[model samples]
Target: MADWQGVSEFVAVAETASFTKAAQRLGTSTAHVSRQVSLLEDRLDTRLLFRTTRRVSLTDEGDTYFQHCRLLLDGLREAESALTQLKESPRGQIKLTAPVTYGEQMIMPIILDFMIQYPDVEIDVDLTNNQLDLIDSGCDFAIRLGRLANSSLVCKRLATRKLIVCGSPTYLATNGTPHTLSELGQHNCLRGQHDYWRFREDGRERNIRISGSLRCNSGIALLDAAKQGSGLIQLPDYYLQTALDEGSVVRVLNNYQDLEEGIWALFPHRRLQPLRVKMLVAFLTDALTNKVL
Candidate 1:
């Protein structure tokens, strides 16, 4: 307590540039404030301020110390505020957006469970493939999959999903498995929204353009095509996991598979997020990390 005795008073004096004003703001006597500040400078063995009859100014060392102390003080205040918020139930609406299929398959279920637990909280979910501006659309946060583009939004990684390139066992038996990246040319490769598939070759990333008899934007439809032995299909693990486990589809080019993509919750920069938003983000993080969603 002795070490901390005059720090607040000194900071107040530095900010107000008046011992009397600092005392007034702190609800303490001017002589007490001056005495504390004097004791602080004596303890630190440095002159922190240049006192004048009309005004006060900080020394060079004092200015640097003040900057660090200001940050510490802010962190302390935020901690107190967070504690206060924790004592109250999170009651408000959380507006969020995510990719259409993932939102339906993974995120929505967890959100529904959260809503059940917190009856006072309301959620507005917008599922779309298009990347909407969170600030413009008035969303608190968004769920993004795959490789994210460089942006100013703050991100929290929730999980990761692998992209798999697979074909039905019957198709591979007849068409022959691809042994090398170049062999992909001779084989029919199913295309989704993009005509290319991402891969990592020899420690570098590559996008290989492919073509086949069928082209569809729906992952479910493409998974069906691969099941019926239409051709090779590349999709996320969520779509191909069940088929792969059931032996209906066989993964190929494991060595060339791209690194697992991130599952992230992104938010616009704000000084302090509301308790509800923080709670929802925490809930989603735990659920996704545990694979409960």
Candidate 2:
């Protein structure tokens, strides 16, 4: 078996570009570091480094080996960190972002409860409609809704939100409810954010272009207009739940409402996440499991 100590010494020398500096960093003698690297090269039957009187440099094979060795060392350190964190309580500030409406109505309450449970934890949340990059924004995690675009970030589904089409009883009584996709085109539709509405027809997904006298980007405004008998509006269950319960708006196209969007907690791609982040995700998953909205 290869000597792990020798491999570590070789990596230190390769990174510092000098055995003397590597020794200084490792708190060992220069000769000892050089000998270890030499032993490492001998074990592999390859010359890993080229040395001159002034400085040291890696050979072609040495460069490739250094890359892999660096990653291996980093992973080892991360594993050790994870183990240490396992023994400690989940305590740290977690910076996260989420969409405005869902964050206010759904996530904020859960987060409040979470803070109460983990007294040592601090949470900083940004509630905005705009999607922010997790790494660039310095957020530990983010809550995202709807279909996510392909990306390198890791995602965990916390819950599901059903899309519902609804209108006020007064409007439905006068204009009639749409039973099929074709009938939807004849009535005024309140568009929100998207130009087309999503539905499922015969097990196939459909995006129908909708038009109306009022087109708004805010879901709350669209819902309000729909409640006042202005036009039919389609929205996620979180936005329409109270209205549905109060009989302010009645759901339409129940048979065709097929698209169910996921509420996801997104984090950076890493082999091991911080324990605090993991704990928060688990807490959210448990809190939201089987939730209707």
Give me candidate 1's TM-score against the actual structure: 0.70
Tell me which residue pairs clash in candidate 2: none
In terms of TM-score, the best-performing candidate is 2
Kindly provide the TM-score of model 2 when superposed on the true structure, using C-alpha atoms.
0.75
Runs with alpha carbons beyond 4 Å of true place in candidate 1? 1-84
- Please give, for residues 169-262, the per-residue lDDT of candidate 2 as tens digits: 9999999988998988889999977888999988999999988989998899999999999999988888888999999999999999876788
lDDT per residue for candidate 1 within 1-293, as digits (tens), equals 78777888888787677898788878999999999889998998989899988889999978887777666666776897678687668888899999998899889999999999999999999999989987656789999997889997889998888888899999999999997888889888888889889999998999998889889999999999999998999898877767887999999999998888889999965324678888999999888877721
lDDT of 1 at 184: 88
